[model samples]
Target: MISIPKDDPAAPDAFPAAPGAPSALETPASPSEVPKETSASLQMPEGLEFYAPNYICLTVFAVIFFPPLGLAAVYFSSKTTEANQNQDWEQAYINSGWTGWLDVFAILIGLAIIYVYTLYM
Candidate 1:
């Protein structure tokens, strides 16, 4: 344990304070004086909020089961949505359909390779 020396010139007073610190007795400003703007005022992109869930699920399934088909689906859906003026459910539908097709393609390719190897050996 350590003890402070009373006679030391470097020792601080009991009520020691900083030069720029606000006094404890002072009160904060009223609510009316504070800014009214809040983070909730900001708006997110419509496409992002609408299509994020479908896009995520399709992309995940594609990656795990069919890389090529997944790539194709991602490519086509992006294109169709870009071409149309009224996006509607275009993005979601395209993504799901394409992802499913690609998965099927991948499964077929795997089967073909297996068949060829079996025949040769």
Candidate 2:
């Protein structure tokens, strides 16, 4: 638990930096002078690895099952590939997850159709 002295109420400068340490107010005045990393410039750090999933399973499902959902899955899978190539790990992961869901849905729908057709016929 944090206990504040009665004499020192919470204020902007209530907490002081340790001696010789730079304060937030001491930051550079110009944004250009400050070094920053942007998303576009991001790269997969060395020693860490990410493997993009191939579209083989999704493609097979698309070929044998629902074409529409399969197509959308393939589309997102393509986007995942693009992101992987660009080293955009976040986007690649998102697109890959989306593709995975679409593939799952397509498989479920296909199985349902097969079951229904066999039962009705």
Candidate 3:
């Protein structure tokens, strides 16, 4: 007679069974009966949607120079307004304005550095 130990690696059934077992593979809940996932829902705040144009412009400016950072700034700033509509428009405007200026400054600085390095080389 052959005996298989519970911890034996060769035994297919050696591992403990999952809780739901075979039922775990059954069909998922129907669309209507399923609890609606609220994760994807957009919950915008009160007044910020109006300044979408500013956000777009900032995003464009960012893309012209540092593509990744600009894209990230555009993404975060856009979401910032969406997450809180009641936020002050003046503040948003100032923040976007500075972000645009910084991107421009970085581009200029990079160009200057490259020009100087080429001259020295």
Quantify all predictions' global Cα lDDT against the true fold: 0.56, 0.76, 0.56
Task: State the lDDT of candidate 2 residue by residue for 37-62, as single tens digits.
Answer: 55456665651378467465766686
Please give, for residues 1-121, the per-residue lDDT of candidate 1 as tens digits: 7778999888877755555544677544776554444323433466445542235455555555556666675675565454332344556566546655665666566567678889998
Model 2 clashing residue pairs (backbone): none
My TM-score estimates for the predictions, one after another, are 0.33, 0.58, 0.37
Over the full model, what C-alpha lDDT does candidate 3 score relative to the true structure? 0.56
Of the pair 1 and 2, which is ahead by TM-score?
A: 2
- Candidate 1 positional error at 31, Å: 29
Off by over 4 Å in 3: 1-49, 52-87
Q: What are the RMSD figures for all models against the true structure?
A: 15.4, 11.1, 16.7
Minimum summed lDDT over a 10-residue window in model 3 is located at 34-43
Off by over 4 Å in 1: 1-67, 73-88
Q: Rank the models by TM-score, top first.
A: 2, 3, 1
C-alpha displacement of 14 in model 3, angstroms? 68
User: In model 2, what is the error at residue 59, expressed in angstroms?
Assistant: 3.2
TM value for model 1: 0.33
Error of model 1, residue 7, in angstroms:
74
